[model samples]
Target: MIIEGTVLRGPEFDPVEGRVVVEDGAITAIEEESVDSSDIVVPAFVNAHTHIGDSIAKEAGAGLSLDELVAPPDGLKHRLLRAASREEKVEAMRRSIRMMERTGTASFLEFREGGVEGVYALREAAEGLDVDPVILGRETVEAMEAADGFGASGARDGEFSRERNATAREGKIFGIHAGERDPTDINPALDLDPDFLVHVVHPEPLHLDRIEDSEIPVAVCPRSNLVTGVGVPPIRDLHERTTVALGTDNVMLNSPSMFREMEFAAKLADVSARDVLAMATRNGAQIAGLDCGVLAEGRPGKLLVLDGDSDNLAGAQDVVRAVVRRAGAGDVSDVVL
Candidate 1:
């Protein structure tokens, strides 16, 4: 198969008039030449962090505190998840996954709620879909064993040393939330030495130093922080220290759309458009260990083609800027994932 357009080729996302050739499911070649199409081909997105389990409760708790909204155990999100039937949850999650496909997301890293049952439900929801989910099961080591890894609620919630060790023993991903509300839990979360930290909204000098020294990655959710009244992560500060990626946290608080997350993050942070685009694409893939975030030879054939001539994006002087800060769902023409 051949897709002709202005391909944003490779991790640098350099624009060139070209065609991408795919055989089976891997990209074999990127041939540069003049093309008649006005399409912008970019790598499909990898959402670094998400909690799509509460998808059945979208926009349910407005004006709630960060803790009241999502702080585990008896948080409103947990209550909603417990209240919903498995069938209902599966259907809602399925719809969200389908929406992800339509919006050009190739994969997402999910902090799935419930336990082993929750992990299985998400797998059921995604059984026939192309939008892959990397699930980190919460609550139990058995859930981690059943899923891809363990997703701790936060350091404040419990002692995760055992779960972390179990995940390490199994060679699976281990992630935790830290510093969302304050700098208090950052140290404990860091001590576990997990694969990634989510929502480092209040990292202090010490935490930043530790992150830089450890070379751990972060998944920042700007929109969710703003909506929940927690301060947003310092993108420039985090990016300079270690790898930082973008995530749209909690379906109850925000839509699971990388385009919306990228636009919000780019305009809110004092970073270059290319850096923001990297946060939306390759940076997230880097955190999740996925191989399909960049357009390159011998990589997975996963990319989105947007109509550059569409009224929403027509005549944009900077292609990366337009995609990162201006383009929307309407600009998408085709998604090959």
Candidate 2:
């Protein structure tokens, strides 16, 4: 297969008029040449973090506090999950997956609830879809063994040393939430030596120093924070310290659209468009241990093709800026995942 366009090549996403040649689903070469297509070819998005199991409960708990919305057992999201039938949950999750594929996401890191059954349910929902869900099961050690890794709710919610150590022993990923509502749990979460941390919206100077020293990657969900009324993450500071990726968080709080995530992250944080694009693409791929985030030789041929001549993106002066700050799903022509 050969895809020709204004290719966003390499880690820097430099715009090059070229064609990417794929053989057996692997990119063989990116040859520079002028082509007639106005399609914008870039690496398909890797959504770093999500709780897509709540797809059945979008916009259900308006004006609820962060804890009231998604904390644990009695939170609105959990209540809705309990009420919905397994079939309903599966269908809802399927729709969310299809929406993600249509919007140019190739892969996602899902924090699945409901234990081992939850991991299986997501698998059923994703059947036959090209989009990959790297599921990290919550609530049990067996759940972690059943899925890709373990996704702890938060450090303050419980002690995850056992889960963390178990996941590490199994050579699977272990991620935890921290510094979302406050700075209280940041130290504990960091002390657990998780593979990554999510939602560091309130990192102190010492925490930042620790992150820099430890070189831990972080996944930020800015839109979800705004919806929950938590302050925005210190994205700029975190970016300077370690690998920072972007995620859409819970389906109840926000749509899993990488375009929207990139736009919000770029505008809300003091980061360049190129850096934000990296967050949506390579950075997330690194966190999820996927090899398909950059449009480079020998990588997986998971690519997105957008109509640069579309009404929304025509005549843009900067390709990367247009993609990061302005492009939407309407401009997407094809997703080769």
Candidate 3:
């Protein structure tokens, strides 16, 4: 397969007029030359954190507190999920996955609820889709064993040493939520030595030091935090300390669009557009252990091509800036997953 466009090449996403050659799904080479296409080729986005099961309940609990909206068991999000039938849930999830496909997301790291069955349900949702999902089963060790990893709700919610240990023993990853509402639970979550953490929106000085020392990768969902009344994450600080990726969080709270996530992240942080683009791509892939986030040789051929001449993106002096802060679903021309 040969894809021709202005390829965003390598980790820094340098714009190169070239054609990407893919052999057996792996990028073999990038031949730099003038191409006759006004397409912007970028690495397919990797959304590092998501609770896609909440797709059945989009915009359901408006004006609710953070805890009231998503704090496990009897929370409104869980209540809505419990009320929905398996078929309804699966269909809703499928629609969200389809939307992600149209917006140029190649993969996502899903923090799934409903145990082992939930993992299988998400798989069913993605049966014929090109966009793949890495499901992390919540609440049980068996669920973790059944899925790619375990996703704990938070450190304050419960102790997760058993699940964490089991995941490590089985060579699977374990991720937990921490410091979304406050700084208190950050220590405990960090102590679990999780593979990654989600929503560290309130990291204190000690927590920052710990994050730097442990080299933990944090997946930040700033828009979700803002919507739920929790403060936004320190994206630039976290990015400087460790690997930081962008996520859209619950579909109930926000749309599962990497474009929106990248836009918010780029505008919210003082970081460059290139770094924000990496957060929406390679950094997330690093957190999830995927090799398809960079458009480089010896990587997977997953790519997103947008029409540079589209009304929304035309006349931009900087391609990366346009993609990070301005581009939308309408600008996408093809998703070469």
Per-candidate Cα lDDT values, in order, are 0.93, 0.94, 0.93
- Worst 10-residue lDDT window for candidate 1 reads 66-75
Q: Could you give candidate 1's per-residue lDDT for residues 121-212 as a string of tens digits?
A: 99999999999999999999989999999999899999899999999999999999999999999999999998999999999999999999
Give per-residue CA lDDT, model 3, range 1-337, as digits (tens).
8888889999999999989998988899999999998889999999999999999999999989988999888999999999999999999999999999888888999999999999999999999999999989998999998999999999899999999999999998789999999999999999999999899999998999999999999999999999999899999899889999999999998999998888988889999999999999999999888887999999999998899999998898999999999999999888888
TM-score of each: 0.99, 0.99, 0.99
Question: What is the Cα-based lDDT of residue 275 in candidate 2?
Answer: 96
What is the model-wide C-alpha lDDT for candidate 3? Answer: 0.93
For 139-165, candidate 2 gives per-residue lDDT tens digits of: 999999999999999988899999999
Q: Candidate 3 — number of clashing residue pairs?
A: 0
| Per-residue lDDT value at 291 in model 1 | 93
What lDDT does model 1 reach?
0.93
